[model samples]
Target: MRLYWKVVLINGAVLAVATLLLVLGPFSVSRHPVVSEAVVLGVGLLVMLVTNSLLLRSSFKPIEKVVAEYDAMFERLEDERAASSARALAAQEAERHRIARELHDDVGQQLTVVLLGLKQLEQRVPPELADELAALRESTRDGLDDVRRVVRRLRPGVLEDLGLPNALASLANDFAEHSSASVRRVVTPGLPPLSPEAELVVYRVAQEALTNAARHAHADGVELSLTRVGDRVALVVADDGRGFDTRTDGDGLRGMRERARLAHGELAVTSSPAGTTVRLEVPSS
Candidate 1:
């Protein structure tokens, strides 16, 4: 029962016992009672108070035990969930690395050979074919560079070698090279060191967001930021362009959310007539 009800019950019982004794006992000899009504009532109240205090004290142990068990169980479950997520992220990263290696060693090498063959043919072919061969050569170069860039961004070797700052600079430079707008990256120092998984998540999300801004958003400029807020790290990518409605979930948006979720973080995209902003927060704890 609730403590208030228990107190009431105990007080009632004490009052009943006191009243019964007072009425059942003989009357006082000098027209006064031996156990006065005030005395009986006061003693009953005191007894009720003491008994209630003891009852409450006894109840505390069980409550604490239940709370402690709940906390322990919740903690264990959380650890399991976090571990599962980490494994999934590791698997994804491994696959990305494998694909990048295959592109660099297998497909990339073959493309280089084909370009060499085309150059050799251009030298031997007729003078009338010269213009066509030149066009083909130029096209091949652009296509190969584009493919390398896309593959590199999908899985950047620079990120593994030079860390996030250098990787972001390279990534931004690549984007700016391909587009008219200048892409700026500001990586604040003194930020907490992120695990490899967290770094990948941030980088991938920024990459996609920048690509979207340059290709579709028609933004003249974009800013990418990486910083720490208290015990949490934050990544913000903003663009000054015709903003998009965030409620719509395109492939890029879905990819961004998956990256955040893989890193055990939260993502939010806010866009309006002014601009678009993608914010990510990942807590160390």
Candidate 2:
């Protein structure tokens, strides 16, 4: 039987028995009852209250068990989801590292060779061909630089080598150079140490937030700050520009959320007409 119906039935049966005893039993209350009669009525009422309590408790046991089971199930599912996300993110990073290595070792080297060949050929070429060769060499140099930039973005060797603080500072410099926005970077000294996963999550989230500020928000000024908050390290990126709705889930926002979940960090975004702020807090090592 459903819990609601079972409770209703139990309560109704208890009330019916009490009503019958009151209406049909030998126990009668006078308008002005004697002390013994009053004591007897009080004891009966106490017994009825005890009986009702026992019945209701028994009826609710199944529901309580079911709720406990559901709670455990949900907890297990959440753990599994987090594990899956971690695995996927790790694989993605590995792939990116491999691609960056190949680009630097193979494609980047080829471009460098071509640029050098063009430089050598420029000297030997006739006067009419000199301008064309110079332009071609410049284009080749630009392509090599572009490849190097892509490798840098894909691998983030700076993060691995210099740690989170310097990595973030580099990111801020890059953003300022590439975009119209002026960036202010603040990294608190002696911040708590973070696990590698936590550091990566923080870096990626900061990178995405700055990219959004540049590309979408058209922010003139951006601030990136990293500090220790209680036992956790916090990263905040704020911009002064037209804000976006936080309710929307673009690819970048979703990726940030997934990374935050993998690191067991908290991600919060507050946006208004004036600007937007993205904050991430991760446990310290």
Candidate number with greatest lDDT: 2
Give the 10-residue window scoring lowest on summed lDDT in candidate 2. Answer: 78-87
Instruction: State how far residue 64 of model 2 sits from its true place (Å).
Output: 1.7
Residue range 40-140, candidate 2, lDDT tens digits? 89988898899999999988888899999999999999878877977899899889989999999999999999999998888787989999989998998
Model 1 pairs whose backbones collide: none
Cα shift from native, residue 107, model 2 (Å): 0.9
Model 2 residue-pair collision total:
0
Cα lDDT listed for each candidate: 0.80, 0.92
> Which regions of candidate 1 fall more than 4 Å away from where they truly are?
1-92, 102-153
lDDT of 1 by residue, 1-285 (tens): 875676577657756775676678653333554567557656656876786567666756677888999999999898777667557767887887888888878878887887888999987999999999888888878778876986775688898889888888887898899988777788888878888878888888888888888888888888888888898889888998898878889988977877787788899998987778989988754
lDDT of 1 at 274: 74
